[model samples]
Target: MSIYRTIGIIGAMAEELELLHRHAQMESETVKAGLVFYRGTLHGMNIIAVKSGVGKVNAAVCTQALIDLGAECILFTGVAGAVDSSLTIGDIVVSTACVQHDMDVTALGFAPGAIPYQEISVFPADEELRSLAVRASRDAVNGRVLEGVVLSGDQFIASRDKVQSLRDVFQGACAEMEGAAVAQVAHMNGIPYVVIRSMSDQADGSAHMNFAEFTVLAAGQSYAVIEGMVRSLQQA
Candidate 1:
């Protein structure tokens, strides 16, 4: 038996979700709100996996739908661009916290990245889940595994200046298009959630080329980590 009755797993790309789907047993799928949710069991745990389209709005929508369907917790797995230069392709980053790098409202006197009513920027991941992710990454990933803040924005970071700017502001390990938005939605709903990512690029001018060449390898690394996490939960 698993600790949670039902877990929600979300990814922005088809490749990410496909890997999970292939591993699922007794799976059934339903489409709603332009997203497809796959309900099944993985490693003895009940799961709902969805391929959320790219970007923040898409991620939030999928998360809310998962919540409406009675998901107790959410897990996001995908590839990210490395914000810290020390990170390399296939290295895993398990998010300890998440922030929307594009959420700037300084003109309204709110600090950059702060939500108007919340008056806060960074949102912490669920400690228990983050810890489990770290352990799983250590067990499964071949490259370095790190736990740090992850920044999300609509833009795909592909320039040195943009990457440096985000790192300077958020001090994050990785940058992606959707993680922070999913984190915010989960936070508001009082659901525990964690974000796990594999670095596919350095978030520099060569990012696009690097991503195209290494995304498959990075995704495989992330999938292994996620599998290890599910196994850990099943045993726990």
Candidate 2:
């Protein structure tokens, strides 16, 4: 059993942030990088949580700030558009790893998702954290839980063709706006990380409408899994 002294959580939207605020008993809050951070305890484990807006750059900045504030591990939670056809609204997709789907240097002979001068553009999550997350997901989500690659980019995906292309290139389970950025920052900083995303919509023509309707349900699933993960870590 192992527990990090302090864990940081980054949620992408109001729905996700609200669930976090309700779950953790924050004692004090501070503003850093134009983001408000709440410090408290979640199921007896120290927590610093924030809403990092909804982009790769924003996520990167907030992750570094959390690291500076003494977060031993970083967790990114939110809703995503499903890339895998099997996933439906309310299903959870815990990342085994994540990739920046928009990073392209194919002209320079680098892979579509690869970054120059880096060993790999696909950043892996901490194994133990992943295991805990998967277990917690199984318990917390009523819908199916899957562990697979999560693709992240700045654009909100709302096209079936785009989804098919991403799945073909990256083999991702889901696509979102922030997870891989957080993964990259956490990896570079030598901190353990995990990304737990709930599927709010299929990445199809009707994605926006579905997301609007189901984001709260998806966010709730994510919060439950994250809460379970924290409780299990505290017990461990």
Candidate 3:
């Protein structure tokens, strides 16, 4: 049996969380701290899922609520903009580390990505969970599955310049609004966490249009990978 009695899953968008909730067995909902939490079972595992609204603060609040609700581990799955030129829509990025691209303190001698009082700029994902996710992604999606850095910020990345700037600084595979914040909170709480993102658009001028067209499709791809990972953990 899995060691974790309760697993927490978070998504930035309603579409992503809603799909998972639909697949969950014996699901029930509760509202707390302006967020809705869904308690359920998937692949015979007890799970709590939440749609974290949009940004870092929302993600952090939802994560903490999940922890308070008895989650032992956390998993974040959502859609992202491709930061790398090689990544295409539907490609999955299982984050090895997450960094906030907007956290800048250069005037205070801290590096651009560094958080105040934190030694490392990047927060790492749980190794065991990441491995399971990578394996599951390979089986779930026909496109490439990569393990790399995911950069997060409050702004939606929709320009080539912004993408290039983030890549130059963090060397990230994907860019999103919530993953790094969730990672930071999990790290502080000493909880094992993992982030899975499916590319919904290239962070370019066309990003808005691309995301509008592919968000649902990308969310489905991410959900498939997460489902596979849950099954793997269940059998283990």
Candidate 4:
């Protein structure tokens, strides 16, 4: 008896999504936008899950597709590079809002991270959903659970300089390729959305190595949080 009728979930990679797929009672599969969307039931709530691949356009396409398929809410989950200095690998970040860190319009004085012409550039997460996610995350993860902005870009953050830039510009807890785009779509569609990221790397010189070693662990943390959220919603 969740308040939301159906939840759409988008994961950024195979490892990010593989475990959850096994848990959901998949009823049907649809292939669209080069992504396989699994329609199913999880924790007594209707869910449509998909691996959104990577990057902004792919994530945006995945979100809209889920909406078209009747998802009332969107949940985007995956691992990301930590941008905040306080964050460590394995920390979980539940986005209060999302921003495209790469969306620069500085020349036109639109300010960094602003999507020109849009009423709001930094898309917001649903307040109710955000609270639910935060509560669930604390219960689900052994690591630190944080509430902050999620920064998205088409690039894999590896440089320390770039990480500092993002930290100064957006104050994001995590930086990834897809979450903000998903947020943008959900915002435009007037659908409630939440983006969850578990830190796999520090977005520094050793990021790639760290990401390779910790992505699965980080993804597991994120999945647990998602499960916790679904259970909370169902019981509510």
Candidate 5:
């Protein structure tokens, strides 16, 4: 019997999943049963990919489902709005940690971005995977590859003020819809995971106007780096 290595991918938008799936062959039975699952190869490693809708709750649910089916590592791959001006569109961000910037408990005296009601300071990315992601980012970046924290929440950030607030409180470089939640779920289940995202826009007034034109291309660039990382893992 072949030793199976299961890797889960959570694509935030429909285009992300569609672009990823396009990289796989459409053979019947390749997809795993009873889950919105698909199977394919990356650097000769078997992969199971799934779309995790959008938002924290949806991402959590999909992550648990992947864990239940024996995914050893889950990757949240998609696009994010850059909080750091140094990062431009198409720059890949491989997070060292993630924060739910929207999580607030000020009355309880916990600082925003604190793991609510817990002593843990922040959620860490799997170091081994992070290393590989860095390598992959280096290979794929058109502009630059930045490693930092990515803030997660339901809303798509399209304001300079909100983006500035996130940067101020979390020191996050990018903002996405699902990464932190996926990391939290993976942590709970003892599964290792990481987030790899490409900057789609600066989270400013221009973001909303530019989103439609850039989202797919940004997601494709993200998928390319993620694919490289998965391939590297297979080789090792």
Candidate 6:
């Protein structure tokens, strides 16, 4: 209803959304609500940021809804557990591509990690947006920016052994519950999108033990990176 241009942002949890919303409010125009959309003007650009709840289905549904509401680009921002040894809590992972780690189709004659009914095993991110995210993460914090594949699954991977297995198999940088699904939705709709996640915990050894303690700092760093990306996108 207002100006028409829109960028969709999907936050996987309430805390994540709260951070994004707080940043949005600091912009000049307050967000306006529609039947299924929350519209705001940030740096003179229209944005619709929504909490996609959790899991793959929820993320996909919310993404589709945003696209239907006229979003041209979708950005999935939130926290993830680190899969790579080089990463640490609070580091940013800017995805080069995403895959569903939980997907298994070998029994049905499809390869493991491939989406059912889909030919491609990997879904790539929008290059331009990925570049912007990398720069933003570097600018936002002294945190290192890891540009690698992201693996998404239904499980919350806090197990070191399990995380190591996944890392060995997929060589993924981070593990989250929603990135691949969000990417799939965007790909299907022919819309541009990118997944940006901050490391909330190490996927190995003490991941489970330290998750509670690391979440606050992880989410805060994640918010700053995403906020910087939003601002960068506006400049672009």
Per-model C-alpha lDDT, please?
Answer: 0.87, 0.90, 0.89, 0.89, 0.80, 0.80
Show the colliding residue pairs in model 1: none
Model 5 collision count: 0
TM-score of 4: 0.97
The TM-score of predicted model 3 comes to 0.97
Candidate 3's residue-wise lDDT over 1-236, tens digit each?
A: 99888889898888887678778885688899989888889999999888898999998898889888988999899999999888999999999999999999989998889988977769999999999999988998899999999999999988888888888888989999999889888988899999999999998899878787898898888788888888888887
Weakest 10 consecutive residues of candidate 2 by summed lDDT: 1-10
- Per-candidate Cα RMSD to the true structure, in Å, reads 1.2, 1.0, 1.0, 1.0, 2.6, 3.7
**Pairs in steric clash, model 4:** none
Off by over 4 Å in 1: none
Clashing pairs in 6: none
Higher-lDDT candidate among 1 and 2? 2
Q: Write the per-residue lDDT of candidate 1 for residues 32-87, one digit (tens) a residue.
A: 89888888888888888888899999999999999898789898999999998789
Regions of candidate 2 where Cα sits further than 4 Å from its true position: none
- Separately for all candidates shown, the number of backbone clashes (residues 3 or more apart, or on different chains) is 0, 0, 0, 0, 0, 0
- Candidate 6: lDDT of 209? 84
Candidate achieving the largest lDDT? 2
The per-residue C-alpha lDDT of model 2 at residue 167 equals: 84
Candidate 3 CA-lDDT value: 0.89
In candidate 3, where is summed lDDT lowest over 10 consecutive residues? 18-27
Tens-digit per-residue lDDT, 83-133, candidate 4: 888889888898999999999999998999988888899888999889988
Error of 2 at 82 (Å): 0.6
Per-residue alpha-carbon lDDT of candidate 5 for residues 46-126, written as tens digits (9 for 90 to 100):
677787788988888888887876678888888899998799887888989988888888878888877765666467999
> Ten consecutive residues with minimal summed lDDT in candidate 1?
17-26
Error of 5 at 27 (Å): 5.5
